[model samples]
Target chain A: MTGTLFLQTLVDGLILGGIFSLSAVGFSLIFGVLGVVNLSHGIFVLLGAYLGLALKEAWGIDPLMAIPLVFGALFVLGGLVQITLVSGAVRRGSLMSSLLITFGVSLMLRDLIILVFGPDVQSLSSSWLFDTFRIGGVIVDGARASGLIASLLSLGLLSYVLYRSKVGRAMRATAQQDFAAGLCGIDVKKIYAMTFGVSAGFAGVSGIIVGLINPFTPFDDTHWTLNAFVTVVLGGVGSPVGALLGGLMLGGISTFSSQYVGSLYPNVFIFGALLLMLIVRPNGLLGNAYKGSV
Target chain B: MNKQISRRTALGLLGATMTSATALRAMPARAATDGVIRFGGSLGMSGRYAETGLNIRHGYETAIKYINEEKGGVQIAGKTYSLELGIVDDASDPARATTLIQRQVDEGVDFFLGSYGSNVVLPCAGITEAAGKVTVQVGGSADQIFTQGYENIFGFFPRASRAWVTSIEFFKSIEPKPKTVSVMATNSAFSKLNAQAAAAGCKEIGLEVLDVLELPEQVTDSSSALATLRARTPDILITTTVDQNSLVIARQMIATETNVPLLYQFLGPQLPAYRESLGAKADGVVMQLPWDESLEFTDPTFGDTQSYIDYYNATNDRPFSYHTVGASSCITTYIEAMKAAGSVDPLAVRDALDAIDIVTAFGPVNFTEDGDGDPILMGAKIGQVQGGEIKVVYPENLRTAETLYPTPTWAEKG
Candidate 1:
């Protein structure tokens, strides 16, 4: 391939990677802090997109302006679900139970979205976002560039909240040892709810970006969830920076294969790479060695 | 009587009386001549195919309502029988669709309506055929359904194997005369067959087949695919996939600015939701339409095309598409067959369906021996989105608007 084409592919991959990284970060955060595999994470992403779309349609608010409202709505919903249903599963101390609970929640959310949206594909339209710009003979989509920027900003904010805040310290402590942290005067329950809320909030932001970038349907949740799961596992289950790296790797490989190898079998190359990663380093590039946490 | 009779004699007397009463009760409550003709089927009401499923259901419902309320039910054997339709939600799963068909069969439905999409319809066809019931449906255009030699299953839509022939012919007629084509399809039964046909059809017409990409059905992103298209830069890009996949491909093509002169998709571009979602981006995209509101055809049972559209639009919250028209035409076909055969017997109706030839809102309704609509006699029209409205642009007689040749690139479009 020509240098320009290669560079164009790389640029596209990076933009796509930004969205993938944001999607994975939320799933990773919940797994890290709550030790729960939130199966409904993808639905939360979709819900976020739909909420943004709804707000735009109902009140003529710009999608960018509706992000905070989407985030706030999802945060409250995540907190409530964590407290009401997920908490019991977590308290039971069975990873399987938590997985099943989240799976059920995912199914319910999927059906509810279908009920409301009627399973047809919907997209967010911004006139400015549809414009294209050129850089050194490589074309770049305005919406995707914006998505990349939003994804980076959201990830940066999440990193700050996780590393530099008192709540972050308490949340980390709770993740390491919930009972010990509770005894040490950390409100473990509140930390758990906060972690879910933050994870879902991240998902909300990712959703808006995704909706702006591509058309989505209620059935798209499973595919998005699978993509996010692959990203998180490849990057390391608990590391945001690792997720970014993993996302970039996945995006690059996928785009490169489709452009050069063949469009039909890109997934074969992508999952093959993930399989190789798993065999060589099961804990992922940045993840610590696995230990039985639950 | 109690004092005089022995226990055995009294028991025998009561048994005889009860047996007679039971026999009388077991007889038909209403005369056989006054019975209702029940048509049963399942639809994908709550899954990936829900959009098409709902449209099919609405079509059948509207047809049945029209027959009952307007035509005063289907006349059979010198008697008017009220048409009763029993539909179940299959949730877009073939196995569930089969189970629902079985349940409907067990309920003793006289006939069956086919489900939406080829995957669901194929299995449901097996059940209906095994039960010896006549099934007429507008969905499931895959060639396999016809190749199976299922005498009981009749499809109203043109075969998937021939679905793209009209589109290719239209492409050939363009002023610029496109030379190369790229075909992409989701890796599903119906889509694969359609894409294969499209490629073959293009090749037969002396156009170079640039590439054929068989993508997985669960693909949520099409950026990589668009990247490939941008590189190949075929004159025309054709995507034969389900609604969601096609929508994603259309959006990504625009987002990545893959500049093909002409774009066509299987089912997505034809949908009202496509225009609503993509706005001006949906313009210039071409598709094969089984029915459009502009058609001036009329069925004896459903009156004119406009009448069906009016009734359908008045009853349904969403605007009706060709799927609705096709499905309603299936019901119209059944009504015509029953009226011709003068019997509600499945075998008779199946025979009548095989022999009956008529035009409806969708188009001509004539079935070949394989139970597919005869392509030469009845088929889809090629349509393009002109000014946000789907206008029939092929078959000179039905052309509502002229073809906008060499569609503008994303950058060029207003």
Candidate 2:
């Protein structure tokens, strides 16, 4: 490939990685805090997009402007679901039950969205953001650039919360050892609910970005959920930084394979890489080796 | 004396009631011969293919409504029988389609109207063929469906392989005559065949095939694909995928500013929803379709092409797509076959379908030995989105507008 083409592909891959990283971090947070895989995480993203679309169409609010509303709404919804349905599974400490319950929740949410939206593809349009600009012989999409910036800001804020806040310390302590943290005066159940809320807020932000970048349908969740799972596993299962690295790696591999090898074989390359990663380092690049949490 | 007579009478009455219940259980078998011609099929009403499935359902319903109200039903074997359509939502799952087809067969539906997508139709075809039922379909055009040697399934549209022939032919007719082409399609069987056909046809017409890409079905982004194409920079770009995939590709093309002289998408660009989604970006994109509202044709059931359009617009939320027209044609073709055979029997209708030749609101309907519609009679026509309207630009006689050669670049348009 020529230098310009290679650069263009790299730019595209990184843009895709930014979105994937946001989604993976959300998924990773839930798993890290609750020790329960949130299979419905992708649906939270889709639901957020739909809400953004609704806000845009009904109230003339731009998708970017409506992001905060989407995030808050999803956070509340996620918190309610955790309190009402998921707490029982977590209390019982049955991982399979948690997986199955969340899977069921995902299915129900997908069906509900389909009922409301009628399975037609919906897109978020920003006239100015959809244009393209050239940067040193490489084409860059305005929407993707904005999405990348938004992803970084969200990730930075999440890191600040995790590392610099009192609640963040309590959440970490509970994740490490709920019993010990409870004895130390942390409200473990409340921390779980808060973690789920924050995790879903991340998904909400990612969803708006995704909708701005691509047209989405109700069925898009499963595809994204699978990609997030792959990203989490490839990165350290419960590590946000690892998820970011894994997302970038996957995006680069998908883009390069589609460009050089064949578009048809990108999935093959992705899964193959996943297999190799699992075999070589099951705990992932940054995962806790002894914990084997994932 | 009254009490003694009641004991024997009660025993006789109980035996008579038991006999009546047994007779009532056998009533459904007789209902099949009750002079009502029932058509049954499954539609993808709830999943990825739901929009297209809804269009097909509306088309079939419109045609059936026209037949019953305007044409006064079909006269078979010296008696007039009204048409009844029994539809079930398969939720776009092939397994559900098979199960629904078997249920319809058991319920004694006289024939089947095929559902949308080749994946669903192929499995439904197998079930219908095994049950000795005849199915008239417009959704599936995969070559595999024809090669199965099943005489029961009849297609109303041209094969998937020839779906893009008219678009290629239109390109050849342009003044500059585009020479290089890049083709991409979703990796599904139907889409793959569509892309392969476009590539092969372009080669046959002396255009250099720059690239042929098969993207995964679940791909939500196309930036990398567009970036790859930017290096090659073909004169023409062709996409053979569903509406959503096509829309994504089109938007990404605009975002990346990858401009070509001509762009043709197999199915998406023809629909009103697609145009609405992309707005101005939808302009200058050419499409190939079997039928459009502009076509001038008269049908016995629905007065004429214009009338059909009026009816569809009046009833449905969106304008009639090619899928709607193709689906309506399937029902009309079956009605014509029944008229020719003078019977509602599945075997007789299947034979008559092979023998009958007629034109409907969509186009001419003639099934070849392989049970596929003859491309010569029902070939695809090229349409281009110009000034926010889809206009027929090819086939000379049916041309509503002249072909706009060398579509303007995104920057130029802006």
Candidate 3:
């Protein structure tokens, strides 16, 4: 309606884009390095948030301080989860079975979470964080600002690991060609496990940030997962930078539409956009640059 | 001769005493007065409808605890006996709910308190009825729950359609005659049912219904629904969804420059999340609530809105959400019925519930058996979200505060 309003909406979109980018990056990492969908990525986010919430509220741990602890915890949890459930499917030697196996694992984790967490919407109430900053007469939530920061941090760390570590090299090798990598003396299983763990650890970080930003219900998992999927797809499924651009684009479009038109129709718009993308740029923004395909 | 006679007499007395003691010990562990009144609860404590289930469970448990403490036991035939409660988590699954109900029936549960969702309760009602057990649909608002006409099925919550009519009566009080209504829902059975009932109610009241859209349950984006409605320049928008979805919808509506008068069904938009997310957009959104601060009940502290809010906030410590409200209310109702019935006898509890007036956090609840034998409780209040808070603005005397948005000029005609 006004210049100030439009600017405010754009700023809001940027913050949301940051969150989308953070969440989708993990999914992208897992797919790029491990060639697995890891369908339970959403559940891992939930678990991470719940764990963070529990630590802060139940055990009196500070939310910020709990991040490193959560990251470490989820790293081990991810490895164990993959070893126990996905291992069986992997051993069976069918690519399609991996998806099915992960889907089942997701379902089981979802139910198990319900059993432990019950059916209540939980939040670590931080009213002090509800403050807003007026930038050029446009308002933005203070907590969302912090969330964007956290998301960027997670994304940066993930990128660093991918580009600068021994594990990263091994992961890249496997992703390029698993058989050749195995012949090159890279333990493919260990690389896959580590990549999954890293991906989940990033998800954990996103979860902590999200928990601070919004009230989480277990049912919201589907929305988050789908959002991540859409982000991954738009970003070329495996490119870190592509995921970032895709998140920003979708986030900006959705937020702008929500402000200018209506928020309810974003899903329809997203689907339409996806269809257009499929036709126009099947390889996505960065294409094969980020993904070393098998 | 004297010693022999004394010894024989003593032996006879000892033998008689020993036999009587053994007979006393051999009797059933619980006296017939303590006859096991097995009450079964097949509840959805997890999944989409978990909040309602959990809240109702709290009410039921607390009431049971109070009843036992006050009377020292359940009063039956002018005698007191201990009460036992058994429950199963149905996870909002209809099949699981049915199985749980049957399992409880086999375990000899006298009365059944079913969960909050219609999908689970409807099927569970059939299983309980088939087993000849009386079932109280604890907090389910499905209109058909009563109309099913099963002799043993009773809906503790008021019918959704009736509630909608009452809410509209309040809406009618808004200035210009409201028109161009938009109906949005989560597509869940209960949410859809509420939306359908509201649409029907609006039609009967001669209001224009525009843009009835059903969104998936976890719709994070509500802008499209708002934009579509905005295109029509609707005077009032009605939402039949949970607090989260409602807040998102309302906020998006405001963002889209369509700040029309709004009405909501059982799901509230006054929750902290809604308020926080909607920010200034939360003001003046009207909704239907079973309980309002203005409504007083016979239970000194029981009927006050604050008591429920306090208990809920004390238990949850967050902003009051409808999920918690509905859940707690249902649980509280069941517990009160159990307390009154005392013996855990399903028939007795159902009879007690039907006969006695229930004073909950909402208001006076009086159930009349329908032709199909389900109890129909008729009571509702109109609330509006103001400054991130839900306040009553209905029935004049029942109004806790003023209505937010005077009906838009466009709504004046029909």
Candidate 4:
């Protein structure tokens, strides 16, 4: 391939990588703190997009301007869901039950969104952001570029919260050893709820970015969810940084394969790479000593 | 042509027939009068294709609305009544559609209009047909539906499988014939069937098949598909995609900077999303379709499309899609058949559907028996998407505009 085309693929891949990374980090966060896989994470993202769309269409609010509203709404929704359903699952310590409940919630959420938004693919006029920014004869759309920036910013903020904040410390303590952390005055249950809420909020925030980049339908939730899983596994299960790197890597591989091999075989390449990664580096690059251990 | 059964009484008869399947064949023939014939439609309400489904629904409703306003409704024997139409959201689910069809049938509807996808239509039509209700498929073109030999079912949309060979014919008729072509499709039953059929037809025409790519059904992105195209770098890329997926695929092809022309069989650039997403990239994308708005058809209803477009704009605040074109065709075709039969008898409507030459806003449309003993319609217009317009360019008599983009050099180069 020519240098120009290769560069073009890389740039596009990075933008996509940014999206995958954003989606994966949120999933890993919930998995890390609560030990509950948020299967409905993709639905939260879709919900956020739809909320933004509804706000835009109904109240004439710009999608970008309505981002906070969308994020807040989903955050509250996630909190309610966590208190009612997820907390119960975490309390029981049944991972399989958590998976089933979350999957059920995901399907219900998908159906509800369909009922509310209708089954049409909706998109905003992204011409404001979809414009080509040229770099060395290769053009990358600004929407994707903006999404990448937003993803990085979100990740950075998440890192600060996890490392520096009071809730962050409790979350880490609870995740490492819940009984010990409970004895040390950290409310393990509360940490789980807050962590899940934050995780779900991230999902919503990233969903808005996704909507800005591409048209979205309710059914697309599953695909986004699946990609996030692959990213988390690839980056390092239960590790936020690992999820980020994994997302970017998977995105790069998939986009490159689509550009060079065949768009048709990108999934095969992605899963194949995941298989190789699993075999060679089970903990992933920059992953924790324990990945699926917890 | 003038049967003695009235449309309202036909509904009553249908209700009686559905009450017991055994009563379906023995419905009493009542005296016919042209009344406001109500036909109920169940289609993809909200799903991946809600936009296309809604457009098709608008087309049918518009045709019905116009016929009622202008022609005073379909004439039977001597009297005339306006047409009343009702549509329900099936959401493209078969089980939900079965319930909707049953509910509509129980409500004493005269005829039933089916949806755009086979997975939705096959079971829905079976329910309506089992009730001995005349059903017309508007959006869906599954070959099996027609081949099963159900007497109550009639199809308005051209079969998807047949369009490929017609597209090949159109390609051959072009001045500079395209030699090397690549095919790609999402591995859905509908898309795969179309892609495989088109590739086979291309090979039969002695055109070199450079590559064929099949992707998973839920391909969110198209980077890998674009790379494969760049690798083979064929002259034209033939793809069978529906809704945003196709638009995404097109955008990826453009984003990747591969300028190979595209030949799409299922969806055309008549969709606003297709043009909006691809912009300048859409130029030279050839779409095979059966209808175009610019055609100077003698049918007075042809002019009604503009009014329908206005209606859709007024209702949805957007222009009508190509799907609306098919939708309107379905409604008009059904009305004409009902007019010919002069009664809502399911078997009579079926025979009328077979016999009538439907002069639609789109073009002359009617079905003929195919090799599998199924009713399949033939013909498609070759339109090139250029400067955001899907301009019709083939079939000299029906040509609406000149080819938008010249056949790109990529179509002939090694």
Error of 2 at A55 (Å): 1.1
Top TM-score prediction, candidate number:
1
Q: Across residues B1-414, which tens digit of lDDT does each residue of candidate 1 receive? A: 676678878889999999989878644332333668888999888777888888888888888888777766666788877777798899889999998899888878869988888889998898889899989988788888999889988988768887666787787888778899999988788888888898999999998998888677766567767766777888888888888788778777777778789898878888877888778877899988877788788777768888888888887786677888888888888888988988888999999999989999887889999999887667778899988999999977789999887888777777
Model 3, residue A263: what's the lDDT?
A: 46
Candidate 4 lDDT, tens digit per residue, B293-320? 6764444454555555555566454357
Give me the candidate number with maximum DockQ.
Answer: 2
Scored against the true structure, residue A137 in model 1 reaches a CA lDDT of 68
Per-model C-alpha lDDT, please? 0.83, 0.83, 0.66, 0.72
- The number of clashing residue pairs in each candidate reads 0, 0, 19, 13
Ranking by lDDT: 2, 1, 4, 3
lDDT of 1 by residue, A14-128 (tens): 9888889998888887888788888889999999899888998899888888989999999999998899889988888788998899988889888888777777678887767
By DockQ, highest first, what's the ranking?
Answer: 2, 1, 4, 3
Q: In model 1 chain B, where is the ten-residue run with the lowest total lDDT?
A: B26-35
Interface RMSD of 1: 1.8
Q: Of models 1 and 3, which has the larger DockQ? A: 1
Candidate 1 stretches with Cα past 4 Å from truth are: A289-294, B1-33
Q: Which lDDT tens digits does candidate 2 get at residues B383-405?
A: 89988999899988889998887
Instruction: State the lDDT of candidate 3 residue by residue for A69-155, as single tens digits.
Output: 888888998888777777766567565877888778778877877777765666543533445565655555555677788877777
Pairs that collide in candidate 1 are: none
Alpha-carbon shift of residue A134 in model 2 (angstroms): 1.5
TM-score of B-chain for each predicted structure, in order: 0.90, 0.89, 0.77, 0.82
Clashes in predicted model 2: 0
**Against the true structure, what is every candidate's RMSD?**
6.1, 5.2, 9.3, 8.7
